[model samples]
Target chain A: MLLIDDLHASIGDSEILHGVSLEVPDGEIHAVMGPNGSGKSTLAHVLAGRDPYEVTGGRVIYDGVDLLAMAPEERAAAGVFLAFQQPVEIPGVPTMYFLRTALNAQRRARGEEELGPVEFLALVDTKRRLVDMERALLDRAVNDGFSGGERKRNEILQMLILEPRLAVLDETDSGLDIDALRVVADGVTTLRGPDRSALLITHHQRLLEHLVPDRVHVLAGGRIVRSGGPDLAVELEAHGYATLDSPAVEPRTASAGTASIGTISTGTISTGTISTGTISTGTISTGTISTGTAR
Target chain B: MTAMTRPATARRPPSGTGVGMGVQVPERAREPEWLNAARRQAVAWVDANGFPSTKHEDWRYTKLDSVLALPLAASSGRGAEDGPGSVSSSDLPTPQLGVPRIVVVNGGMVPELSTLGTSLPGGVRVESMAGAVRRPEGRFQQLWTRRLGGYPHALRALNDAEALDAVVIDLPARTVVEDPIEVVFVSMPTGDARWSHPRLIVVAGARASATLVETYLSVAGAPSVTNALTQVELGTEAELVHYVLQGERTDSFHFSSLEGHLAEGSRLSSRLLATGGRIGRHEVDVVLAGEGSQVDLDGLFLTGAGQHHDNPVLVEHAAPGCTSRQLYKGVVTSDGHGVFNGHLVVRPGADGTDAVQVNKNLLLSERAEVDTRPRLEINADDVACSHGAAVGRLDPEALFYLRSRGVPEREARAVLVSGFAHEILERFGSGPIRRHAEELAAAAGLIVLDEDHCSSGAVTAGTVHPGRGGRAQ
Candidate 1:
């Protein structure tokens, strides 16, 4: 449902994402793992159409439509949702009021009839149980004085209410406790369907245990260096990203097969053997490419 | 005191016949000895101090040039065709919260037009000032003689000098009046320029409690000047809630002085709202005279294009254990200008005094302007006193958040502005008073939505109708 081709973006004088290419097909979940300053959050913001991040090159196609040409609200109306890393606290505006306005605005933009108060409240109540959000929180000013866990749950609640076609989760597990992570992961798992797509951006593989993805891509130096099955996450966890810096290792194509194993020298600058072999489970492709070190 | 003189540009009209001169006073022989002497003294004081110049500290931000240039005449007994004579109780701004109302047309109290019952509670007196002054031994005479000139103000002296009548409310000791006393002053100018000076005196005896709502409204596009003075005295342990609403014509001017004196353990809450007039000024001076007294002062002013409003409040903590609070908010749009000056003083002997003052303003347009000065003069060592003042526009992030949710930009701004004013309006302590304030604010194009609209499933936002002016409909 989403296709990003050589997307080059920058903020001010520094270019964050350079020639990054990836795709999340319909009905599949993809995870992007990168270290600090890997442009993980920057990619999410650019997708949500936030300002000041100039898209200098390439394009994004969502369901065959030009995604970069739409305004933020227009993107939201067109079923593009980005769960922010930190939800903004809007004082004097109640949460329920904001939700109803947003729901109606999106529905109106899509030529759908607006829901009445009773109908909107009924829908909200149904979604509130899915995310375990308190009714009192809905009555307060949007995220005003809310705890870290409550803000994440509120974001999930909004996602459930809007029921967008594509969802982008940026560091959704950054501040969650063990129980909150399970609940949030369950919320994302429940949103899985044949037509829905999701891109999970995180620095840790712990969240992957709760909500497993079909594809795991290691993003480093503003590019996706490797793509493999879910086992790639387990491998990255066992050995840290230091192994990915070996000169012998190269970029891998996702069709290379399931478990594209490589052997490397056990020294500071490891030299590993890259292989691209097709297995019955999946395909893995590896080739020699410039290994950009993580900053 | 030295004799005050006018500037070189000040024109001296015919001294014996003009409005501010000595001709407006009543015949000396027809009045009581004390009344005649008081009026003569006031008139002499006003002549000595022509009019307050901008150089005076109190009138620094407000200019009276346009107000002084108009030729002022006393209102005739016959009410103008478009005055209060044509207005029904249902047509009032806050008809939803009805109370026993007294109507004053031009400057004189109209008994036929008033809605006061034939009899009031025992030990409570509500009568016209003219009637009270005529009585041989009335309580109004005693209260007036003791309270009329308690303070020295040039415009207040002018009001007392040429005042024709007033509304005098007296509550005896230990009395608790249930309903609020509503006094509506309607100004309707004649063909030529005219001005009205309406005076009111309220005295709450020891342990007495009451609520007073004073409303000043003028007909559409009336060219008139309303110079009003109100003096309040609260005895030991008395409680009083005073609310004043000023809604006049955009082409007219309004000047009012509210002076309050609180005695031992007395509690006073004063609220003032100004939403009309080409230029309006409400000066309030409050003194906590006895130990353990408390006072609360709140005001809100909304000004649009070509309008100017000023509020200068002075609160004095004189006795130990006295407390005072002042919060004033203003929203200026277009070319409108607003001013707020709050001065709080804790005397040397008032060691246990507690005072807080805050003034916040929102400027909606590039041309809009606000001048806010919150001054604190703390002389007592054992006192807690703080003052704050802020002037800015709405938070850009908050605005963007609202707009991102599909609320139109104008409606979002209106919501923020309403919320800013709601902080002070909620302090009214009752739903009816707050609702009344919301109605008045809505009439001024401030976009106040009903509570049901928010709690219910309705997603409709409040709309702004600046063309409606101050009319209820």
Candidate 2:
């Protein structure tokens, strides 16, 4: 459902994603594992149409539409969702209010009737149980004073409510506990269908256990070095992205769209494989990327 | 005292008569002697200190050049339209709260327009100041006798001297008013700069509880100046919810002062929403006079294009175990100006005092400016006091978050702005008053709220649905 062709993005003068080539086909969940500063979150943000990152080259085609040409809201209306790694705390915007506005905006954009208060509330109540979100939290300002686990769950709740066609999870599993991870995984699984697609960006393979992906692509030096079945995650979990030195050597079987682009753009491929330990523990400064890093 | 001369740019008198020099004090044979003397003394004070210049410490950020240039010496009481005659009642911005309301036209209470009438509840007295002073043996004498913080402000003294009538709400001991009493001051100017000194005197007896709403509105873009003053006394253990909504014409000047005295264990919540007036200035001085008293002061000044609003609040902690919280927010756009000055004073021997003051402003444009000062004067050794002020544009991440959720940029900004004002609006307390304040915010273009949100008693997120801002193609 989503095709990214040699997407090169830069933050200011520093180019983070040199040539990211990946694809999440319809009805499949693809996990993107990378070391620190591999532009994993940069890909997610660029997909979501976040500002600050200049897409220097390449195009993103979602369901035959030019996704990069659309505004953030337009992308959302077109069924593209990005679950932020760190949800922004909006002090005054109520969580439920924002959700309903978003849901209605998307529905309206699709030429569907807007849901009234009663209908919206009913939908929210049904979705609330899916993520075990407290009703009190809905009344609060968006993500303000919410714990890390609750924020992750809140993101899942939004995902369930919006029910987008393509979902991009950017390091959502970083700060969540096991239970929250399970809930998030269940939410993603429930959203799985023939028409839906998801791209899970993570630094570890622990989340792969809950929501096993159809494909696992090791993203290193801002390029997908290897693509294999779900076993690729297990292999990386045992060894890590440090073992993957060569780039684009694996058979381009991730998707039909990626198979055409056999040779990924050759940029400065650093052999300095920043360990996942350094990626997860310390702050990784990737130019203006909203990954697992503090904004 | 030195006899100060009028400045080169003082206000021009309305006519060649001494009456228009200030608020014309009405003379009746049966009026109390003390009131007449107080009025005379106030007039003399104004004559000596004819409106402080910008050099004055208190008037530093506010310039009265435009206000002084107008012919505002004539009071609204005389030669004005009779009893809402000129302006139709439909033109008034009345909040449909379904409570007992008193309508004052140009500083004079019109009995025909007021709804209190004989339905006024027992143990409660809602009358004009003209009527209260004639009672001879009421609490109005004592409450009006005491000075407010011993600081005689220039505009306040002018209001005292020139004022003709006011709304006096007297709640007896232990009386709990179920509904709020709303006083709407409708200003319909007669083709000139008319000054209306509207006063409100509220005295809640011991253990009594009541809610009061004072609304100031102008009609037909009138050129007028509304000099308003409110004196409140909350008796021991009494509670009072005071809300002031100022939505005058952009060509009008609104100057309001509120003096609150809280007794032992009393609680006072003062919320002000200023959305109108070319230059709106409000001075709030609240004194925690007795032990265990608490006060919550919240204000939101939403201005746009050629408008300036200033709120200077002073909270005096005179007794021990008193708590005072001040939260003031402003939204300035398109060259609009907003100012907030919060002064907190903890008196000596007033230990165990907890005070917090926060002032936040949102400047939407580069020219939109806000001058905020949160000053703290701590005299007591053991007191928990903190003051902070922040002025910035809307959060970009928050805007992106909203937009990324399919909300358009304009609607997303409206949501964030509404949310920013929601903190202060929620402090208006639940029920119709809060709804009215929300409606006022929406009307001022400070926030965008839908119909469902307006009718809801408690403003919930469930009710907020932004307008369909150009459905994403």
Candidate 3:
């Protein structure tokens, strides 16, 4: 459903996502695993089209259309969701109001009728149980004074309400206790369906245990050095990436209009060197998608 | 404790001095010797010193050049020369101050408008400040000289130096005033550019509770000046809630200083709402004189259409464990200017004091103006004191969200302004008055209610319009 092709991006003076390439077909789960700072969060933000994360090179395509050209809210309306590692605290803005407004924004963008408050409330009540988030969170200001678990759960709640075509979860397990982790995993599992795709970004393979991925890509430096079945996660967690030799992943279907993604060497984690999220390795251009439902 | 333990100096008025030069009497009052004596002395001082000018720290922003341009009216006007009547009854204070209310028209009390039953607890004193000075056994004698200087205003000094008539409210220990005490001062424009100073004194004794609502209102659209001063003392364990609503005629001007003292364990909450007048300024000075006391100073102002409203609040923490919170908000439109200068000072050794001060303003027009300054001078450590201030226009995103939901352009703008001001108005404990203040706030455009958003006719639902740049005024 989403195609990222050799995308190169930067924040301020430092470059993070450098020429990264990836794609998730319809109804599939893609897990991008790398050590800390391997451009996981950056990729999610870049997909969500956050501003000032300047794209020095490459494009992002989603649902058979160019995604990088869209604004953040536009991308949001086009069914692209980014679950933040740390949700922002917007005090005084009630959660229900924010969620409803965001939902309507997306609906209105798609030329669909926006749901009334009554309809929205009913929908939220049913989904609240799926995420195990209390109904009280809906009445409060968004993310204000919420516990770490509550923030993560609230993100999932928004995701469930929006029901985007493509979902990018950025370190959803970072602050969660084991209980919260299970709850988040279950929420993701419930939302998994034929028309949706999820890209779960994580450092640990523990989340993979709950929501197993069809593809496990080890983003040791920046590029996906190794791509294999879910067994690669179990292997890395056991012996660490030290013994996991860097092998060339699948080659491109065809050379794109832009420069090919650069080769990357696996830097030892002990070096304490690279800031880790540099994206020159496997960044992909999103322009490959041609039209709606074209995937 | 000695009287000199604090900064209040006791001068005793040079005993025999008479009403000094340039000071004229407001009107004649049949008075007792001591009352006339204090008036003569005060008048004498004011006459010798005219009123404070731009050079005075407090009078700087105020342009009293009009006072200087006066064919000044007599200091006092009698029965036939009333100002409140000149002000159309429709414009006079509505929602009558429901108590044994006192109406001080101009600087002297009007008996026809004054209603007080002899229902009083024995030993309790409630009289006019001028009458208090005249009466040897009244409540004003003891508290007047003791607390007047605590709120220093040249006009107040002038009132004290020559205060022939003032309002004095005294609640005896353990006394409860079931009904609030209301004081309404309506400036009567009897002559061109006349200036009148009305002074008020309210003292709540130990365990006493009372609500005082002072409306510095007006009677005429003509240019007139009302300069006044109020001193309140809340004794040990006493509670006082004071609300001052100052809305003068567009052509008139107003200047007043309110100084309050809270004794040990006492609580006082005061709210100031400035809605009208060509130029209106209210300065509140609150000093927590003893431990375990709390004072709340709240204010809301709406300035637009060539109006200038200024509310400068000063809160002094003189003892430990004292709490004071201040929130002031306003909106300025069409050449209107709103100024809020809040100073919170924690003197050395005043520990564990929890004080919060915040000021937020919305500028509805490019020409609209706001000057917000919250100054904190904390000399004590281990204190939880915070202050913040901001001034800007309504949030466009919030506006868009509201409009997209079918709230029209006008109503949406009003909701945002009112919501911002609501944060401050919510502090007023009185619901009815708060509602009235909310309505009064509509005039300033500082806050607009939801009902205010709906335009006339086409009752059901309508498309929300978007307003940009300036007030689609």
Q: How does model 3 score on DockQ?
A: 0.05
Model 3 agreement with the true structure over B23-47: per-residue lDDT tens digits: 5443334555544565565555555
TM-score of chain A of each: 0.83, 0.84, 0.82
> How well does each candidate superpose onto the true structure, as a TM-score?
0.81, 0.87, 0.66
Report the Cα lDDT for residue A246, model 3: 65
Q: What range of 10 consecutive residues in model 1 chain A has the weakest lDDT sum?
A: A261-270
> Candidate 3, residue A140: CA error in Å?
5.4
Q: What local lDDT does model 3 show for residue B40?
A: 60
Ordered by TM-score, highest first, the candidates read 2, 1, 3
Counting clashing residue pairs in each candidate, in order, gives 9, 1, 43
Cα-based lDDT for every prediction: 0.74, 0.78, 0.68
Which runs of model 2 end up more than 4 angstroms from their true locations? A247-295, B1-33, B78-87, B93-99, B117-121, B138-142, B148-151, B448-473
Please give the lDDT score for candidate 2.
Answer: 0.78
In the range B82-158, model 1's lDDT, one tens digit per residue, is 35545454445556344457777666676655666644568787777655666666666676666555445567876
Q: Which candidate leads in DockQ?
A: 2
**Per-candidate chain B TM:** 0.88, 0.87, 0.82
